[model samples]
Target chain A: MAAGKRGNVYVVVGMAGAGKTSFLERVATYLERSGKPPYIINLDPAAMRLPYDANIDIRDTVDYKSVMSEYCLGPNGAILTSANLFATRFDKVVSICDLRAQDYEYFFIDTPGQIEIFTWSASGIMITDMLSAHFRTTILFILDTPQCQNPQIFMSNMLQAVSVLYRSRLAVILVFNKIDVASHAPLVKLLSDMSLFQSELEGVSDFSSTLTQSLHLILQEFYEHLKIVGVSAATGSGVEEVISVLEDVGAG
Target chain B: MNVFLSLRSTTNHGTVLSPRRAFAPTFSMPYAQLVVGPAGSGKSTYCHNVHQHCASLGRTLSVINLDPAADEFRYPVTADVRELISLEDVMEEEELGPNGALMFCMEYLEDNMDDWLAEQLEGYMEDDMVIFDCPGQLELYSHHSAFKSMTEKMTGWGWKMVCVYILDAQFISDGTKFIAGCLQAQSAMLHLALPHVNILSKVDMLQDKSVLEPYLCPDHQRLANELDERMDPKYRKLNHAIASVMEDFALISFAPLDISDEESLQFVLYQCDCAIGYGEDADVRTSRDVEYGDEPDMSNLSLE
Candidate 1:
């Protein structure tokens, strides 16, 4: 698309209500500040509202409501079906991105609310393959900062993040969202300090807590491979650090 | 839950459950609802709304928190699966993914239904309706046999079980999303093999409410026309194939829900009752209620 200047593709995925769309806008804001504005693609056909403008919107290509009624599918199934349908023509989407690849430094794509729907589905693979064909693709896995306080729940959510990391084998950037509401500093501390995690697990001898202890060990290695960023999409804080991390990735 | 194993619990259990002995035909039963949907589809909200609606109807419905992953609930839980086996415990004990751990939690519930759940359930009266606010994991209803087995167990315990599949109203305001919701409900119904009711939750959030009216009942013709309009001509076959299923299955109809509106909430309750024959046995209960009516007036005729 350009002489060594093609854009990077960012596939943003997360659990429902983890604020993926809002976070994408913040990333775009950070990218746009340096005049390398992102070319966005909104892959969630069922999303009711999006904060950012997308160069390619799935809603424009496939109407999820029509797919829902026509396919006699539920919201989950219709989203999947519409995704599959849109995925069939994803080569076209990639071609369009290639056409605009010169103007943008980043190609940001926001996935559906259901993380599994994007990460664990056939359509997810199709979309990823298309992006990786021309662009260096990375997954930004978002986690709700307020929701992951409990060691057990945190482990479960971490396992979820680890899933896409393992499945796609793409470089994953863990975005700890909603930091303005709940700071992730304690969580970052727990991940790094064993004694701190032990203290967090104090007074709990259940299987989950004990397993979370074991998982903390395994996650130590995983943490080595992945990158973590704490961002408040609401207040637009930490957006620069996220861009700096991506820039480092580009450099590496 | 271990609470059911206590001596105080066992003693009080008979007082509540014993009344069912006279009413159980061994087949007919008061209804218990199983709330299901994917994550963030408002299953919890629906459970909260239904609990309030039943409370207004002079019915004390027990809301059961079946999601081991759920941390908070709006209702006062009478029984909870989190007490028996939680995702936290499963994830700790078994090296499983979130979906796997959640599945383990549900299967664990199903395995203990006869003992743990039965004990907890027996403490409530036969007419104390139960609403199971299940996990958002779709596999539990799509293919997993745990819920199906639980349904069988509840049926054997003289409780009619129905699956309430909640879908976000915003998603279904359009055509493609409407089909997805139907297929999801159908998959759940097929797997659970229980009477199912589909709910379009959070209808008030939809910008143009009129867009959803067609999908509530889902007329085949209107849906196909809408599909044709929205989808590309090249994919007409795919669109028609999906629309045809809606016509044939007749299993995908949804009832719109506006949680804040009393009438709307009650309407959904009415649909659920019709699906499960809830209080259809009212004639029997009412007839029994009128027993002492003209008998004491025997001074006029019965004594002769």
Candidate 2:
């Protein structure tokens, strides 16, 4: 969209243990094989070990463990502080990418395990905003398919996704990860057919369901705007669809 | 002394003549319960059920919808925040997202409290037990100062408030989620600084109700042990620290709410009553006194 902006940036964000890194690794391997290896940026300070080699890693700049001990903060606080520390110097990161912009067509950012640490924190928003200003950015919200089979859990994830979308105001692609374990089709079907979700909620017959039932009506507009792609990082399945969807988003 | 009155019909707003007459002097201050939780935690439904339960017993109660994002209501709202401002309208006009629009709507409501919320609250009796069904956004109660300031203003207006923190029973099925829920509830408690009651809402959805026993009155040590077994060894210190925090305060026990069972609902409401000292000043009554006139003695009153 802008002159001199050379690559499309995909920010991978999701709840803890949502297989963000696994999916990223899978996608990176695929891209590497396809002769278009994407530049990877690992932003998760608390990440124990990344499966893919990152071109730029926050952990290289900020020691999360030391930040925790020095500040007398817990794990979450340490991660937030570390992210904040990285966000302050994010301009350098943008410049570094800008220098190498001609070498790569795509940039993938791996966020922290704690979704809120990246999504809710001021530093996280600043970093996201900075990236969007520099590149064609899209959020890849990885959802744990098995965990979301439950209607209540599904609604919770939907709410969080909506919050993240509105907060960032970025184009988001709901990448339903771990479809190898649980198919995302049923969940997608539930979205399309209101009665199916209602009937599933009928078994519960509680007040929460009633509220969720009402929320379904409100979230319809949100769902209509969303682009969903089911992928199994374990099996390297359905990633092409994600790439295609990202391409479409980038083109538009 | 507490002066209990009959609930006016939802359609009988015009029939209420001097609603606050019997409540103002005797009670000196009214009472309120703020029902709040994350999205889909059954706040409005709790308010609806509690309202129905109280009305059945001929008690006067008012339910207020404080969520601007709320689009439906099962209970008749005495005062709705949507009336003054709505999330949809704010999002459309201000070009704000749902969360931002909600925050904007809340602040907008706060700015116009005297002209809006205060006036809407005036129609109800002073001592009528009011339930404010708040928005589902966790930030609003956990750390947001908007709700805190609003509640303080209401307190200044002579309304004793209790915070009803609801979590779905699904949370109890997992140890970590339950801990997260507890921490969220505690954060709200510290922020709101009100008499707090934690409700495990939608317990009826659980196939085995006994699964909730341990969670109801949590044993911090056992919780730690279970959490230790479930979580990775690396998180042991964190788990222990969390458990100790909960144990130190010991203010986070949950009341499992089964709305279908009248006894369960009463128990939950009774806890709220205790928190607010609802009937502490009420006149002593004999067994023969019928709380609701002409109502059948369906309840087996065991005279002490």
Cα deviation of A145, candidate 2, in Å:
32
True-contact fraction in model 1 equals: 0.00
Residues A134-183, model 2: lDDT tens digits: 88888999999998876655756765675566456577789999999999
Off by over 4 Å in 2: A1-252, B1-27, B123-126, B283-304
Q: A-chain TM-score per prediction? A: 0.93, 0.95
Candidate 2 structure, TM-score to reference: 0.53
Return model 1's CA RMSD, one decimal: 17.7
DockQ of each candidate relative to the true complex: 0.03, 0.03
DockQ-based class of model 1:
incorrect
With candidate 2 superimposed using the best TM-score fit, by how many Å does residue B69's alpha carbon deviate from the native? 1.9
Model 1 has how many clashing residue pairs?
30
lDDT of 2 at A107: 90
- For all candidates listed, what's the TM-score of chain B alone? 0.81, 0.84
Worst 10 residues of 2 chain A by lDDT: A204-213
The segments of candidate 1 whose C-alpha lies over 4 angstroms from its true place after superposition are A1-252, B1-27, B123-126, B283-304
